[model samples]
Target: MLNIVEGVRQYAKTDRLAVICGEESISYADVEKYSNILGNYLIDKFNSDIPTVIYGNKDVMILVAMIGSLKSGKAYVPIDTSSPAQRMKDIIETVQPEVIFNLSDKEIMLDSSVSKNVEILDKATLMNLMIEKSNTYDFEISREKWVDNDENSYILFTSGTTGKPKGVQISTYNLDSFSEWISPVLGIDGSEMVVLDQPSYSFDLSVSTLYPGIIFGATLFSIPNSLILDFKKLYAELKKSNIKVWVSTPSFANMCLNDETFSQELLPELETMLFIGEVLPVPVAKELLDRFPRIKIINGYGPTEATVGISQVSINREHINANKSLPVGIPMPNSVIKIVNDEMEEVPKGEKGEIVIVGPSVSKGYYKNPEITNKSFYVEGESIFKEKSPVSALDEKLRLRAYKTGDLGSIDDDGNIRFFGRKDFQIKLNGYRIEIEDIENNLRKINEISSAVVLPINKNGEVSHLKAIVVLKKGINESKLKKTVEIKRELSKLIPKYMIPRSFDFIDEMPLNTNGKIDRKKLYADIVEEA
Candidate 1:
């Protein structure tokens, strides 16, 4: 985990460039000064044994403090400073950080449960404290690994859209394999500077923001918080920087493709667009291809449990036509993917089964819940044991417990895994059961669309109907756009008649939650109010 920091230590010996953001340009040497000061402070205060919560966006201080805390023998929990007060409070209370490094003074107003016992260090106070303390601390640079390989490096709280949030305990070993697998796929290199658009705390997308950029020593550029909502402003800011790689979710990329001002003229510097976090609609992929035909658009797929992405495939027009559902492609090197039946036996090719991934990137389990831990994690052959037969217990114990992915998929004869949809997201509507993702995927085949999301919404009549909210590509007309509803008409030929969305709502923007998922609850409320 300190590999990134140590790399900075090696190349950043002089005052060469390191990090750049709004109103801040710091040298490599300057970063180490702050990192060392913060490292010393953490070593003196926490002694590298307890967990500390680091709350902030992509600030230089947060990066420095993270390295310093880990090098000093403490794990850090990154809180999304942008999250709601209640959500942030819940995370702080759960983690119960012995010490916290935050960027704001208002965080002092956190729940009384946390505000009382937690040691708080705001950025201003922490920077002043670092300035006051002499940087003369011995640089023995303890080769000692402050965090064990399996120990929790960070406690990431899920988006919690399902219910109460669960903390995902990620280990140093998790990150190590993650970086190793993703680095080669992304084609990272020294000259390939990328922008950090997502906040550090958002789980899966963080790999795009942090790991690849640092591993290849590429420069990282950050956008101002105010411009995040404005496509025109964001495009202007992006064009101002010499960014070559743009890594973000398909939603953000679609927004760019749909905006009139966002063309090759503005984003000429961008060459690679790495998309993850959600499915990439085919139309959005085509729009990007239409503009930057030479640019490589990577569609990466994986759940957070698999450490960002285990499978990826480059998008092209021919590949999109070859299959209704885009193949997630082959697993990364040294990683194995197995499709097993309900009985835990390997299923035949082209049969849908639970996707069980085994690799170093898999997390240990959810924190503090052994019941869930045992259910999700267990020896593979334990269920097959015959006590009377006297099978070797040791052999069974060494068998790998395949992580039961909630996702359902199938592998073709060539071993290309195709994601069908989430097992839970499938629901019955009218006389038919449907996978909501399938309708969304079909709607994406339209040429004028940028993206689409489908969900069942309840009407005032107390009946649920399929409703699709669509975001269109640039220059699509409301009159002509409604004509593009023919895509759904075409979809009727493919899917069951009951699966079609009864009504289509065209919107300038889709509501997104803090974690970058479609805010279906909010979308439902908005449609009802409009009705």
Candidate 2:
């Protein structure tokens, strides 16, 4: 893996573009210089070593702040401006950041939920420090302060089975392991190339582009929320952005496919398209192949806890021609894919079981939630992962981190890995891993709701959107339309917009199984399957 901070500094020796968002762009020289300056400022301003929070949407400051935090040996948490105020508050409470960079145009108005001393540097203030305080270049940050080993590279707060979000801490060691594998696998030659980074910075999918883009000196062409909402501007921007390697969800690609101009002529330099964070439909893969005969379509699979993706397969014409399901391919050089049964024992070949990913890229675990972390992630020592020593036993830290993905899959005799559905109520919608109970818990919080159940609405073997069923308290007279509008309006405040249900059903009573658990299968049959 490329030593990201040092790698960028080495690349900064030359005059090259590092990031380009809409009309705005930042150079590698500036990225190195400014991030160093910010690092110094952070070290000086706050004596504490707590993580920093960056609040923005598709801005260059966010990138600088990220590297700056990395340089100062502090992990950074990126919060998208699209996040609801409550969610933002929840994250701030979790990290308790000493300083937060407000690169967005909007004001970050936090109530009593956050500490009053959390310093916020707006776009203007941050630029003033970076530009006006260039004389402080003499105060270079020493490599001793640079992040390494088990220290968190960055913390990503994802949806938890519990109502609140759980932050996944990816250590520097994990990032290094992932970078080493992803670089060679993708054949990134460390030259200047523009890569499309369309996902929101808050999303784990962004890491695929963010770190690699910086390491290889690729120009990250970011697509902001504004452009994503308007097709005309998006197409116009796509025509302008000479992105070579494409990185995004299948849904985003499918949206672009709606435009006839999205073809070889639109992005002639585009050669590779890496799809992660969601299931890539065969039809979508086939469409890209039909459009670009020479394009390399790589389908990757892993949870954010596994450092982006642990396995990838380059899709070819044969797979599409045969009308076969895409395989996620084999694990990386340092990782192994295993299928475990109910007893936590390895399953037989070709048999479906819960997929467990064991590798160096596996995250330490969920932050501030030890109970759930213990339930999901663990460490293992064996010949495959044991650190060899002529003297005696290997160091415990050298063992492999194994994550029970809670996802079901099977490995073929040829070492090919196929993904089945999830083992639990968690489902992937539009690339976000949503725990069904997370939404249900939030729904049950509604004053009028006595009981609530949420289930995924599947279409064409993909989770289209969430559909929720709720039973209001008796005598709460309200029309379905009025109640739904009111409920969604309330839900929007409690969770991210993507987690909110697109459709709702009012039920007379909550169905239960023999064990008195919510009969989700019955609700699915009545609400999603039957409908």
Candidate 3:
């Protein structure tokens, strides 16, 4: 297996630029030097393998800290600057790191209220340490201090239904497996390529671009949250970025498409557009194809539990014109996806069931919570590979670890995986089981509707009704009341009367979270507050 740190080190010798955020750029040489200095500092300071918490956004130091932590045989937990103080407190309590690297320019005051006794390295202090250590200490460290492949590489905290976050521990071996599979699919050659990164460091989506890009010596061009919110500035930056590989959520892409200038002309170097974190709507796929005929629009499917993505398929004109839901694609090499029922029996090829993933990319399970980990992550009978072509001969002996994704999907007759939405998204209304995706998909088929999301409105403890939030197409001159009636009428023909949402809400744009997925939780909260 290839080591990620070694790969970056190989590129560092040539002085290739590794990361670019706004006007700031860092060469691979600097990245290696800074990270090594930090790693040595960490090893000397702590003398233990406790995970370090890196608090920042897209700052270059965040990556340095991540690499430093790994080099010191410790995992790093990345918390975005946008996160609340309370959220940071929760993670601090959970991990209880000896050191917290605050790489942001903002002063993050963590006293007894948040942390008891922990060293906080602010940006100014960290920079001084990096400079002092670089002049005084050697960058080379013994290989024995490097984290073992099976040891945790990073602990990513994800939102939990219980109001507390659950950390998913991904091992170095898991990341290496993910990089092995993703590197080829990303269309990167020996030549340098500029990769567009749109997600926060905290989000696993960044992993899809960061690790693979670094391994291939591709420069990562990141769009900070501020720039992303400003369309004029964002488009100007995109035009200048020369980004060849675009990685973001469908919602972010759709937001970019809102600008007429966001065509192939602006990003002529773009060769690939990767979508993850949510279902890619047909309209969004079609619009991109129409704008960039030569670009490969790839859709990937997986959760943070699986290192970035486990399955991916390049979208084509045929898939866009089919007027049907697009398939998520076949399982990547060294991974197996099974659609099974509640009894853990495999459902018929075309029948919908819970999507379970088993393979190397699976995480070590949630950190420090064995009860929850045992319930969600485990190994089944044996590893089964439906498609053998992509699997490497050497990977046959790899032990399979299974993760219950809680996502409803099925394998089609052609062996393509079709996503039906989340198992939790299925609502029981008046004794009829309804898939929220079904309602949303059918609603999107309406000519006037560009995007739709169906959310259940709960009364007391039970779902009382369904609410459909939609974004109308541009240049539609119809009145809101008239258009709502027409959409309801059109949607009724495709779905049962009971499946249609009782109320319709038209929004100018869908709210997307930091991960770039639809913010259903925020939407529901806003709706409740408005009521």
Candidate 4:
């Protein structure tokens, strides 16, 4: 597989556009030259592999900073511009880099408590550094200066339940492996293609498009966060984007699908739709198929620790027509997925268990966090499984580096993996264990319900009952008391009386986090406030 640097080197000879953000367009040669100049400057300044914190959104320079940091042999931590100062401060303290690349054109005011030892460089300073380096320094670095495959390529900070974010350290080897597996899945050839870029650099979901698009020399059509909120402008851009591959969370697509014009007519060249960061609801898949009959809708499943996705499968017409809950799909070529019970023993096929991934794509571990890393990542050998166990051969072949996904799933007869839900989402209420997704899935099956999220309502520190928040079908009367009663009645027939939500809250749409997944934390807070 061609590494990122090699891909850039090959593409740099051509004048094809590599990135398009708003009215700004950047070519492959410009990307190579600018990144190299910035990289050489970074090398001269830092002279170490300490990660540099890149603060910005969907700017072209954010990509430049990322490539520059990699060329300088340092991993980069991307902080979104919308993130609260406190969150940014926390990351600053955690990574504690010598330099911070502030790509935003506006000045970022930081607290006085922030370290003064760290130098902050904005757009002008960054340009000066590049120009200064270009005049005297050769853009190319010696081979020894290049980061090893085992060394970190980037550190993506993800939300932690403990009120801080944990950094997921993805190595060069991990990224290369992910690119190799996802390239074919994305149908990316060297031929020019426009890949949609929706998520910000901070979110690992962006990695899904950024690396592969760069490697294939495809132009990335980036949609800024501000434009995403304005549907009128967003669709207008989509019509002109000529986007071939649509990469986003299912929620984003569902939002776009609300308009009648979001069909193939708007983007005739659109061939592939890749959904990740959450379960692809059956209704969303069915609608996409209805609108874009020839489009390939692939459902991918993985956490940040697993380098974007480890399992994926294309949603076919059969899956939409027949399956109640769509399967996440088979494991990627470089990865091995096993469903195991509490004791880490492989569960019987078709039985629900925690999803454990063992493979090349698995990240090294959380950066500078051995305790949390040890809890989630490990190695399993012969002693952990029976001699003739089904996974024993895979363990031998793959060397058994594993990550406990904390997600519950099971493999079906056809080798397709079905996601049950998060293990933590399972709650015990009134002496019964229930999966939240089970209720959510059944709730979504109702014709009037467009999107549904189920959460356990806690009473006295225990799950006492279930609460549901649903987005009704566009024309449905959400405010009517009878509408909710009817929804509850329909849900009762699909689920047990006890499993039916105690109360239903109807909304126009579900809240989405930066990564485009349903923002359950925000929803839970809303539920708490209502209670």
TM-score of each: 0.74, 0.96, 0.80, 0.79
Which lDDT values do the candidates have, in the order given?
A: 0.66, 0.84, 0.81, 0.80
lDDT of 1 at 355: 87
Runs of candidate 3 exceeding 4 Å displacement? 111-116, 383-398, 425-531
Residue-level lDDT of model 3, residues 1-531, one tens digit each, is: 656688668888886788888888888888888888988988988889889999888876777888888889999999887765545767888898888998776776665644456789887888888888887554676778988667899999865534356799999888888888888888865478899877887888888888888877889898888897788899989999999999887768888889898899999999999887767778889999989988999998888889878899999988988878888888885667899999989998899999999888888799888987998888755427545445454344344688998888999887789987667875555433355776777677788788888889875334668988889888347787787788887875555466678888888899999999999998898898889
Report the CA-based lDDT of candidate 2 relative to the real structure: 0.84
Residue 93 shift from truth in candidate 4, angstroms = 0.3
Candidate 4, residues 1-531, lDDT tens digits: the string is 447776776799998898899998888887788888877887887898999999888877777788888888998899877765645776788898878889886566666666677789897887787676677664676546766567898998765534456799998878888888898889888898999998888777888888898998999999998898899999999999998998887768888999999999999999999988766778879999999988999998887888888888999988988857888889875467889999999989999999999877888789888988999999766443344436344335443678998888899998899886568875544333355776777677788778998888765334557878888777564465777789877775554455677877777888899999999999989877876
**Sort by TM-score, top down from the best:** 2, 3, 4, 1
Candidate 4 residue runs with Cα over 4 Å from true position: 111-114, 382-399, 425-531
In candidate 3 the C-alpha lDDT for residue 498 amounts to 60
Could you tell me which residue pairs clash in candidate 2? none
**Per-residue alpha-carbon lDDT of model 1 for 1-531, expressed as tens digits?**
335566556546654456676667656666667767777777776664667888776566766667667667777777654555545676777777778888644554566676466678888887787678755642535647455466676767653322234577777667666776676666665554555555345455775657666655666676645567776677767778777777776666666677766667777777777776666667777788888867888887677656677777777888767656566777775456778888878898899998887655667777665676666565444443333243234323322334777678898887778875555655434322355776676577666778888877643321257778888787455484565467666665444355678877778777889999889889878877888
lDDT of 4 at 207: 82
Clashing pairs in 3: none
Tell me which residue pairs clash in candidate 1. 48-73
Clashing pairs in model 4, backbone N/Cα/C closer than 3 A: none
RMSD, every candidate, angstroms: 12.0, 2.2, 11.2, 11.2
- State model 4's lDDT: 0.80
lDDT per residue as tens, model 2, 2-100: 567876787888888888888899998888889999888877777566999999889876888988998888999988988887788889999988899
